[model samples]
Target: EDQVTQSPEALRLQEGESSSLNCSYTVSGLRGLFWYRQDPGKGPEFLFTLYSAGEEKEKERLKATLTKKESFLHITAPKPEDSATYLCAVQAYSNNDMRFGAGTRLTVKP
Candidate 1:
C-alpha cells in the first residue's frame, strides 16, 4: 500500500520563528518526492523535488529533504507571508497518479 502522512496538522509561529514539518511515506518503489505550498482556494505551487536519500532543495525560507522512508520541510526565519498549507506528494513507479498528504497548515503571525 502507498501512503503519505503529515504531522502537526496546524502550526502557529511568530514572525521569524523557525520550525520543521514532517512527512512520512510508504510506497512500493519511490520515484520522487514533491513539496508544494498552497494558498487558500488555489492549487499547490511546487516547491521542491527530492529524488533520493540525502537529496535537498530550497526556495526562499523553505527547504526540503528526502530519504527512502520519509521527508521533511524546514522553515527558516519564516515571515507572515510564508504562512500556507505545505503539502507532500510521492510518485511511485507502479502508479502514475500521485499520493498526497493532508498537509501541514502554518500560520505566521506578524
Candidate 2:
C-alpha cells in the first residue's frame, strides 16, 4: 500500500512572505507525484507533476520539487490570493490507485 503524509496542517503567513509545504510518502513503486491547490468550496487545481527524484516544476509563485522520499511545494513571495489548501498525491507503478495526504492549509494575510 502507498502512504502519504503532509506536514503543518495549517500555516499562517504575511503577504510577500515565502515558505514551503512538505509531503512525504512510502510506496512500493512510484509512478508520479502531483501537487494541487484548492480553495474553499472549489475543486483542486493541478499544480505540478514530478516523475522522478530531483525533478522540479514551477508556476507563478509556486515551485515544486521532488526527492526519493518526499516532495515539497515552495511558495515564494506569496500574497493573500495564495491562501488555500495544498494537496499532495502519489501514483504507484503497480496500479491505478492514487494516494493522497491530509493536505496543508495555508493562510496568507495581506
Best by lDDT: 2
- The window of 10 residues in a row where model 1 has the poorest summed lDDT is 59-68
lDDT of 2 by residue, 1-110 (tens): 69999999999999998999999999988999999899999999999999999999999999999999999999999999999999999999999977989999999998
Ten contiguous residues minimizing lDDT sum, candidate 2: 93-102
Looking at candidate 1, what is the lDDT of residue 97? 91
lDDT of 1 by residue, 1-110 (tens): 89999998999999998999999999888999999899999999998988899998888888898888889999999999999999999999998999999999999999
How does candidate 1 fare on TM-score? 0.97
Candidate 2 deviation (Cα RMSD)? 0.6
